[model samples]
Target: MRIMLDIGHPKDVNVFKNVILSLQEMGHTVKIFVRAKESTKRMLDDAGFEYEVCPYYKSMAGKAFGILANDLRLYMIARKFKPDVFVSPGSPYSAHVSSLMRKPHLAFSDTEIAGLVTMLTLPFTDKIYTSTSFYLDLGPKQERFKGYYELAYLHPKYFKPNKSVLDKYGLEEGYILLRLSALSSHHDLHASGFDFETEDELRDYISSLEKYGRVIISSEKLDWDTIKEYQLDLDPDDLHDIINYASICLSEGATMASEAAVLGIPSIYVSNTERGYLNELETEYDLVYNIPDRGEALEKTISFLQNKNTKDEWQSKKVVMLNHNIDVCNFIIDRIINIDKRGL
Candidate 1:
C-alpha cells in the first residue's frame, strides 16, 4: 500500500511519525507532505524521513488564497505518487486533492474550534477520526478513538525519557517548563494566553517562578532580551524528554500541555479557549489543570510547585490514564490496514 500523509504543524509530525515508520516496516511505501512551519521540516530531517515541503502562507490573507495554490501543488504530487490513501490532521489541501484524485482521505482531528478548516475538509474527506472526548459531532463519517494524538508517540510503548537530554541542556530535574504560543493560527485569532501588559511584566512573572526551581521558557514568538536568559535553545526532538522530567508545565499551547500531561507531568494550560481532551484530562483524570485566566493559572502553578507530592500524585494518575487509553500508534496502523483492505 502507498500511504500519503500530510503534516500541517510540528505536532502533526509527532502524531504521525510512529505510524509512518510502522507502515514502512510492514513493507508499505509512505510519502509525507509537510507545510513549511517552525521546526516542522527540521524535526522530519532529524528523524531521517524523506518528505516534500509544501508551500505555506504566513499572512491570513495569503492562507485564504493559498488554499487553491496548495491544492494545486498537492494535486501535482498526488498525480505522480498515486497513493492508495491520504491521511492528515484535517488538512483541506489533502482533502481536496485526494477527492480530486478519487482517493480516500482520512482525517484524524481533535480541534473542534477550527471551524474554517473543519468546514473545508470534512465535506470532502471520506472518514474523520477523533478522540472520544472530542466535543463536536461531524455526522456519520466521524469515528471515536480511546486515545489522543499525543499518545501516538509519547506512549510508553513508543517513547522513553532519556536523562542524557537533561545533561545536554545543562538542565536539572524539577525545572518549570513554560511554553508560549504564537497565537497566530486561524483558530487562535480570538484566543489569548499569559496576559501580561508589558514585556517587563512578563519577565517579572517568569522571575517569580524561579523560587520554585529553574524556569525554562520555550516560546514561539517572544524573544525580547529581558527573557533571553530563560529562553530554551534545544532541538525540537528533545522537547518531550525535557517535558518528561519537568516538575510542572505551564503552557499556552494545547499540544504541549497535553503532551506533558500524558508524560505524567502536571500541566497548567492557560488559554481563553478549551479543548475536550484537556477538559477530560482535568475532570476525569485530574492530570491537567485548565485555567483560562492568567492570574488563576499563576496561582495554580505556584500551588502545584509548592506541593512536594504533586509529581507522585500525577504519576499515579498517569498510570490510570495509560491503562484506560489504547496505544494510539498501533490503533492508527491497524485502522489504516483495515481501511485499505475494506477500501473505505
Candidate 2:
C-alpha cells in the first residue's frame, strides 16, 4: 500500500515519524505532508523525515484558506504518488483532500478534539481513531479506540534517546519538570483554567516548591521573562528524557501528564480546564493525580509524594496497560490495510 501522511499540528510530528517507519517496515510506499505552521519545519528536520511543504498556515483562519490550497497540494501529490490511502490525525484540511480522491481516509485522533470539530469533519474522514477507552461518539462516522496519549511512535523502544540531550540541557539530579498549557486551541473552554493569569497565580506556588527542589518550566507558548527567570535549559526534541528522569512532573497539558504516567513518574495535572484525557487517565489508568483546580495542585503534589497507595496503585495499573497495550504502528497499519481491502 502507498500512504500519504499529513500532520496538521507541528507537535504531532513525532507521531508522524513513528507511523512513517511502521508503514515503511510494513512494505508500504509512504509520502509525507504537513502544515508549514510554527516550527513545523524543525519538527520534520528533528525527526530526519523529508517532505513536501504545503503552503498552508496552522492557525484556524489560515487553515480554512489552506483547505482549498491543501486540496490543490494533496491533489498534485496524489497524482504523482497515487497512494492507496490518505492518513492523518483527523485534520479538517486533510479530510477535504482525501474525500475528493475517493480513497480511504484514516485519521488517528486522541480524546482532545471538540465535539463541534469532530462533527464538522466526521462525514469526510473514513476512520477517526482515539487512544482513549471511552466511547468516541463524536458522530456516527467516527471510530474511537483504546490507546495512549504518548506519541508512542517516538517511544524509547523505537527511537533511542540520546544522552547528549541531557548533556545539552546540562540537567543534573534534583530538577522538577513542569509542563504548562491552556489547551485553548483544543476548544475546551470549560475544562481547566491554568492560563497565563492562572499560571501566574500558581507561579509563586511552584517557585515555593523550588526551595525544596529545582524547577524547569516547559511550554508551547511561554513569555521571555518566565524563561529567563526559570533559567531552563531544554532541548525541544527530547523532552521525554527530562520527564522520565524528573523527580516530579507538573502540567496543565493532558499529553505530557499521560507521558509521565506511562514512564512511571509521579504526575500532577492542573485540572482547571476541560477534563478530556486527564479524566480518562484518572478513571481508567491509575497513572496520575487530577487536581480539581489549581488551588489543589499543591496539596495533591504533596499527597502524591507522601502516599504509598498512589504509587502502588499506579504500579499495578502500569502492568495492566502493558498487557492491554498494542504496537500502535502495527495496529494502525493493520487497520488501514483491512480498510483498503474493503475498498472504503
Candidate 3:
C-alpha cells in the first residue's frame, strides 16, 4: 500500500513522525507532504523520512483563503504522490482534495472535530482515528478511539531518540526543564498572549524555580538575541529527556505538559484556556495542574516541585496505563489491509 501523510507545522511533524515510520515499517510505502517551518525539512531529511513540499504558506492565522490554498496544495500533492491512501494527522487540506479523489483518505486526529482543520477535513476522511470518542461532533463516521495519544500511533517503543545529545548542551544532572509554547496556532490569542509578555516575568519565575533545581529553557522558537538575553539554553534531544528526568516540567504549551505527565515528571501547565485533554488528565490523573497566570503558575509549580504525591500517584497509574495500552498501529495497519476502500 502507498500512503501520503500531510503535516503542516513543526509540532505536527513531531506528532506524526512516528506514525509515518510505523506505517512504512508495516510494509506500506509512505511519502510525507508538509509545509516546512524553520529546520523542519532538514530534520525530516536527517531522519531519512521522504517528503515533498506543499505550496501553501502558513501565515493567514486560520483565514479562509489559507485553508483553501492548503486544499489546493493537498490536491497537488495527491496528484504528484499518487498514493493508494492519504493520511494526515490533522491537515485540513486532505478534506477538500481527497473528497474529489478516488482513493481512500484517513486522518488521525486528537483535536476536536469542530476544530478548524478537522471541520474542514471531516468531509473527506474515510476514517477518523482519535484518542477518545469525545470527537463525535464530526458525526458517526467510521472511527477508532484509543486510551492515549502516545498509544494512538506513536509510543516510546517505536520512538528512537538519542538522549546523549544533551551532553552537547551542557545538560548535567539536576536541571529543571521549561518548555515554552504559545496558543497562537490554535487561534486563541488570549490564551497564547503569555508568549508576547516580557521575559522579566519568565526570568523572575525561573529565578524562583531554580532554587528547587537548575533551570534550562527549551524554546520552540529560538531567537538567539532574546534567548541569550534571557539566558535560556536550547538542547533539542535532551530537552525531552530532561523532561523525562527532571525534578519538574513546566510549560505554557499543552503538548509538552501532557508529554511531561506521560514521562512521569510532575507537570505545571500555565494556560488561560481550561479546556483540552490536559484538563481531562489533570482531573483523572494527579500529575498535571493548571495555573491561569504566571504568578499562580509559579506557586503551583513550586508546590509541585516540593511534593511527590502527584508523581507517585501517576507512577501507580502509569503501570495501569501501560497495561491498558492498545497498540493502535496494529489496528490501523489491519484496517488498511482489510478495509474496503470503495466506500470510505
The best candidate in terms of TM-score? 1
Q: Model 1: clashing residue pairs?
A: none
Task: Give me the candidate number with maximum lDDT.
Answer: 1
Per-residue lDDT tens digits for candidate 2, residues 74-157, read 788877888788887776656777778777788777745456556556788887777655444566556555566363654446
lDDT of 1 by residue, 166-185 (tens): 88999899999999888888
Q: Compared to the true structure, candidate 2 yields what TM-score?
A: 0.86
TM-score against native, each model: 0.98, 0.86, 0.85
Worst 10 residues of 1 by lDDT: 221-230
Q: Considering only N, C-alpha and C atoms within 3 Å, which residue pairs clash in candidate 2?
A: 131-147, 191-273, 191-274, 192-272, 192-273, 192-274, 193-272, 193-273
What residue runs in model 3 are displaced by over 4 Å at the alpha carbon? 55-58, 61-63, 133-136, 142-144, 152-154, 159-163, 193-196, 221-226, 229-238, 308-313, 341-343
Candidate 3 global TM-score: 0.85
Q: For residue 262, give model 3's deviation from the true position in Å.
A: 0.9
Clashes of each: 0, 8, 0
